[model samples]
Target: MIRPSSLIFAAALGALAGCATTSAPRSGAAVAPYRDSIDLAGRIAINYSRDGKRESLSGKFTWRQSKANTDVSLISPTGQTVAVINVTPSSATLKQSGKEARTAPDLDSLTTQTLGWTLPVSGLRDWLQGYATAVDGKRFVATPANDSVVTRDGWKLDYVSWQDDAAAVPQPKRIDVTRIALGQQVDEMAIRIVIDPVAQ
Candidate 1:
């Protein structure tokens, strides 16, 4: 049987997949890395651990974003779909394998209710662009290079490496994220994304 955490992880993966943007930076000019939106397809490996228990899932993902709507799909290693998540300004829905569709007022609430954990869905778009989304009462810090460590909202994101696509702006290749609570580490996740070369 698939573990609940695995389902949650898959849903979270789906949520992240929804943040990809389709727009590319112009050539031969410096441009801001973050775009208003994006669409992307790639592979993702998620590792989740809490209090010595750990779960890992690796699969393919697709994310499309337009204005306030985002759609994400997570596929298992065996080429079967695991989950699909749809997010909008007011609601989020998750459709899992062999399960009834679940909905909540937002992605965070939906994941918390169905997956028993909350993912940073609101900030993922910014995180995907190598930046942090601002939250009230939260402090965000970034490296001077803007390509390294980013800490915010009790999460520490390490930009391990970047992918250089010819004729396109380089994008993040590997990222490691850790969740902290009360000054102690509680959970961690890693994501490696390969932007579809043909999509650019």
Candidate 2:
């Protein structure tokens, strides 16, 4: 059975268009090193399957920067509107239906539990800049962009694929994620992300 936390992690897999990254921290590894300025405005489609339930979510989203502060909306299967979200670095305000917007901490767990997904950020920021996260124990490299896999705490990971260009998203030709499970019960999870530079 697929867990919800896993879904939260899934949000971290999409590729960004028109994004930018900053130089490595002056000293020591930075918390949010992957900094890219991408304009995510277009018809974005995402497909995810968990526990045998297939979910198809398609809509228009625009992220001027790192998705830190932007307007996001989710379209329901029945052509109904579910929610509208406004996020910022310090906090997040959400408006559902005709209700008022609720302001909460930036790190709200409600998203992962209620939506079966996490706020999409961070990981992609790092990934877009060609950085990798570590995967501990007996792991293999699936797709190496810079011959460097992000090694965090000893986990071996590689973007199964991703855009090989320096261009910010919308035209992300390649986007994939692979995780090697060492001491965990789950062995692996594969995620694919696509960006449409020109969407009508």
Candidate 3:
């Protein structure tokens, strides 16, 4: 079984994966809206709770995405490396601190194995952009100013706030997410993310 601390690291990295990537746009270049495309780098603080147990982790992350693939890295608060994840159409790979690199068919499967639960890696790409994924049963609500909430496929996302960048459209600075599983007994996981916006 994975240790709780390792699970925390894995979960933190999983949460960081989709929003990490890309350098800032060049000076004088038009800033592409996040909803159109994203290449972002930022710092993140993650708080997670399950069954009444809570833990927190802080880190830096870089997320780069292109038409063909995506890559993300999570760095510890003290500047040590935590994990790296790469995703392609056919496969995903995760390299964690002090562990053998592992590969899986997809990001969800890889994170589920490493973290003891799955994160919404696929949906997060849209969630990070203040948009909802095109999944059945999904419900999304947004304010005229762009703050939003989304529920789909057993997960709920609350977009708490946006950064006040001068040149580009505001991007999410904090989000709270929860996943619920139904059965004889309900199981739930809660995650809170605090992001420090980058130039892009």
Q: Among these predicted structures, which one has the highest TM-score?
A: 1
Instruction: Give the Å shift of residue 127 in candidate 3.
Output: 1.3
Of 2 and 3, the candidate ahead on lDDT is 3
Q: How do the residues 113-166 of candidate 2 rate in per-residue lDDT, one tens digit apiece?
A: 345455333344444344544443222222332333534433333333433444
Return the candidate ranking by TM-score, descending: 1, 3, 2
Model 1 Cα lDDT, one tens digit per residue, 1-200 = 55676576666765563333334433443324566667777777777765677777788878777677878888777888788888887888888778888888877788778766777554666566656533333323233244443344666566666565232455665666666566666655544554453353
lDDT of all the models against the reference? 0.63, 0.41, 0.59
Candidate 2 weakest lDDT stretch, 10 residues? 10-19
**For every model shown, what is its TM-score relative to the native structure?**
0.75, 0.48, 0.70
* Over 4 Å off, model 3: 1-4, 15-37, 49-52, 134-146, 165-168, 180-187
Whole-model lDDT, model 2? 0.41
Give the least accurate 10-residue stretch of model 3, judged by summed lDDT: 20-29
Top lDDT prediction, candidate number = 1
User: After superposing candidate 1, which stretches have Cα over 4 Å from the reference?
Assistant: 1-3, 15-33, 50-52, 134-144, 165-168, 181-185, 188-198
